[model samples]
Target: MKHSNGAQLFLRNDPAKTAPLSTKKPLTIGKASTNLLCMPQTDGVADHHAVVRWSVGHGWLICDWGSQEGTFLEGQRIRNCRPISDGDEIQLGKVGPVLVFRLAPASSQPTPEPAVKSSAGGNLEFAGQLIPMNQIKFVQLLSRPRYPASFSWWALLSLGALVVLPWPPAFWTLELVVLAGWIVLGSRKEHVLLVTLLDGMAYRHSFANKVTALGHRNGIRKAIGQPSSA
Candidate 1:
């Protein structure tokens, strides 16, 4: 079966209960009648449990709406808004319901480029090079952490020391502040866009802003006649 544009969610236990995500608005899940994915009879679900929406800079994200039982993304109870990737599982509550996220499928056939000259349309600007959209064979996004796990682990160990060391109140406060900084810094990632040409050559462009990288990748996909996973 084929899915509509944008992303989609299917029930974990029942894939047939698939719902496509909206690009124009948020998809609300709850027992309330106004919710797009309303489950009036579902247990453990609140009136406004959670919402899935698209952010221009962050792509697709799922945020808990202060539900009685918080939402879980792959078993981890999400604190705030968390970016959703393809194949991620979202649980409504501790035991309410489960939904799977999926990206739109690519076209089965290669898109035929128009007869106009490549220069007819403006080329995609990338790292100071002009690339014809038709020359792109594939596009992929890569994300890598800016810091190693050990940095965060050391911060955790320092925080753990306070429990047995009987540190002063000021010292405790300083440790807490440092740990917070470590967490925020550790979570930073570098996003890169990889574009492969039909001739087998490939090029990558890195972006400090995830939204800009996603936009570039999606634009290339659309220009090449493939479905945008945005």
Candidate 2:
């Protein structure tokens, strides 16, 4: 759905655009489609690997990874990511059994509860409220929050080594060229650290409440630790 402010959307699907989520969890994908994009994992279980990036900050989060048979969604085992929709059952690998996911659009409002004459199941012992799907626990595998302990500190050390030292003395242009390539790939972490460093600097220079300011910047309540704006 189009908004003047350009709320978060599934870059892939333009049909039913969404708004900021009720909660900042990854499952609360704003304006994104259920077409899951499973990125390639060299690891045996491609769809289940960490750093899966098909979610555009909003959408069904399938943690289908690592089992002899593999996880199945809606009776279909995903060889690669597939579009998910309401009533889709997600089978987590081994730990828990079958859990279904039901997606409800944001714009639809709850109708008023219908007046009841007599409870149909009044004599039957009631269990609890039926939560249709198991809660999806979201790990922002691709985008780690920029803070100390957010990423493997190994990332920082590698960048430091690359920046201060040149290639070995006996190394030829081939080695130098390879080193440059290494630096290029390793630079993603460096760029993130740079943002963290910038935040650090800002924290040092001012008296503004760090948590509140950062939370606002992240477009979430300060305590929730959500990563970005919608």
Please write out the lDDT profile of model 1 over residues 1-230, one tens digit for every residue.
Answer: 13545478988899877887865678898989999888999887899999897654466789899997899999999977899888999998898889999876555212333322234254565643457777878899998887768485766767676665685876677677777877787889989899888899888988888998887778677777778873
Cα-based RMSD of candidate 1: 13.3
The reply for model 1, stretches above 4 Å from the true place, is 1-6, 106-230
In order, the Cα lDDT scores of the candidates are 0.77, 0.34
* Tens-digit lDDT track of model 2 for 1-230: 23323212232223343332221233311112331322232223333331121233234345433445465666666654555565555544433244334344555422322221123221110011111111111111122222434234445545555666566553344445555655555443311101122123211112124454343234211122334532
- Score candidate 1 by lDDT: 0.77
As a whole number from 0 to 100, the lDDT of residue 24 in candidate 2 is 23
Measured over all alpha carbons after superposition, the RMSD of each candidate to the real structure, in angstroms, is 13.3, 17.9
TM-score for candidate 2, residues paired by index: 0.26
Q: Give the least accurate 10-residue stretch of model 2, judged by summed lDDT.
A: 124-133
Best by TM-score: 1
